[model samples]
Target: MPTPAPSASTPPPAPPATGAAPPGLPPGPPRTPPAPPSRARRLAAPVATLAGVAAAFAYVGTVDPNEPGHYPVCPLLRFTGILCPGCGGLRSAHAFARGDLVTALGCNALAVAGYAVFAVVMAVWLVRAVRGTPSRVTVRPVWWWVLGAVLALFTIVRNLPVGSALAP
Candidate 1:
């Protein structure tokens, strides 16, 4: 027996075509990767960062942290009577800004190392920006743990009489 045809009130259903856009949505233009930033634009961040750091060092160099009432006392040292890893960071920066490496190291060896690292990283960043190449420094989780351990050790040692040399 032949099947009955649909009445005029109902139309025949159509199947969806393969790889076609959803129902009524229009196809979008071809996607393209964004263009790299201009050399000046890339350089802007590093230069601004350097400028800010320089300003901070300048301010620190001008105001002596060694004097009483210049900068706020470290709450850790004030309340807990413990020297944190950053206890003499300002003094170290001040000495570093004044080109006195020995004094900077004497104030805070760890902080002096940090300043050196910052200088090196900024130099690398500026160089890459000038060359129109992008650079990223990805530190691993292990390094962070190591850094934390080192800071803890530094704090402990600096508070000991034997580590008086490390004290501020």
Candidate 2:
């Protein structure tokens, strides 16, 4: 039997071609690109980080860590009679802020290295922030393990009688 044609009152349906865009959408890219941040927004993170670092250094520079009660003793040093990796970090920062590199290294060589690393990283971050680019620091697992091992070795050596110079 022959099928009846659709009445004129009914509209024709859209074709189901795979390449065709969905109804009401433009034919090119589907999404609008996000707007970039304002200049102040881009600079905020780096500036805040630098300000916090400066405040910390200022506090450390003013405080005398060599005095017995200025800062709390390292828990590992006080309780376990062992020097931890961060045993003299405050003293290191204090000496570093005072421009005494030798004393800073003597207080904590690792902490001095950390200060250098922080400086380099923050410089990069500031540049990127000014340019409105995203930046990150990524340390792989193996490097993290190596860092831990190095800290452990430092702690052990600093606690020994022969390495008394390394102790703060």
Candidate 3:
């Protein structure tokens, strides 16, 4: 049997229209996008980090690391009588604060290199932060292993008589 047609009392569905609300529906409120951060707000984090680092450096600069009692000896060096990669990091920082690059390198060349890398990275971070696009330093596992290996080699060589200059 054929199906029956709709009754005359019923209304047909309206056709959809472009850029218009559907029939019987109320229009919603207009959207307002969120505002971007201000320049000072964008720079706050980087500035705080730099301030903390500067404070630490100032403390290290005032302290005399060359004095025997001023800083604790590296536990690894004390126990094994061998130089570790960080054996003279404090001295390096102290010398670096005093503007003695030669002494800082003599203390811990790797640490000095690390400081330079940190400075460059921080500079980039600050620039990006000011532009409201902060970034991160992402070292892959392989690079992390390479860094560890380099530090290990530095430690081993520094302990050897031939690499005495590397010792601190």
Candidate 4:
């Protein structure tokens, strides 16, 4: 005797009921939208951002902003007797370009830290760019407040006679 083939008459399974909402609230908009980004735009934005950063670094590296008259004076330094955290940033970058790490740090340790952070971020950005991945950067409000407090403290300490070492 020969075996028979199975029938193809099986019915499709029913989908679970997911349309109902909680009783207390009215129906609301969808939590997420259906539309998705195009591949070209997704790749273009990261590439543009990376290129912009490279251009900025290149400009800074080429132009000797440390020169007395090369760059415009800071408005804060012009009007106020106090120095801002960014006052020596240009000089610091210049020192960095010249491979003088100590002078760069002395000019603006905060700027040096920022440079290092930016370099690391750019490295990750380039990797993501090549891998065709999306990038997202988010900082908590508490972190922003903490950063502000730290800058304020740095500003105060740099001005004190005892903290002259912190000054540029």
For model 4, the superposed segments whose C-alpha errors exceed 4 Å read 1-43
Q: Judged by lDDT against the true structure, how good is candidate 1?
A: 0.92
- Per-candidate Cα lDDT values, in order, are 0.92, 0.88, 0.87, 0.78
For model 3, how does the per-residue alpha-carbon lDDT over 1-168 read when each residue is reduced to its tens digit? 996686898787664545446578875554456798898988888888889989988999999888889788888878988888898899999999999999999999999999999899889988998778858888899999999999999988998898999988
For model 4, how does the per-residue alpha-carbon lDDT over 39-115 read when each residue is reduced to its tens digit? Answer: 66566766787688668766777898867777899897788867788878888887887788999999889899988
Regarding TM-score, does 1 or 3 come out ahead?
Answer: 1
Q: Pick by lDDT: which candidate is best?
A: 1
Off by over 4 Å in 1: 1-23, 26-29
Q: Per-residue lDDT tens digits of candidate 2, residues 23-128?
A: 8975543455679998899889888989999999999999989888988888878888888889889999999999999999988999999999889998998888
TM-score of 2: 0.79
Off by over 4 Å in 3: 1-33
**Residue pairs with backbone atoms closer than 3 Å in model 4 (clashes):** none
* Deviating ranges (above 4 Å) for candidate 2: 1-31
lDDT, candidate 1, 1-168, per-residue tens: 998899999888765545446768975454566898998899999999999998999999999999999899999999999999999899999999899999999999999999879989999999999999878999999999999999999999999999999998
Clashes per model (N, Cα, C within 3 A): 0, 0, 0, 0
Show pairs that collide, candidate 3: none
lDDT of 2: 0.88
lDDT of 4 at 85: 81
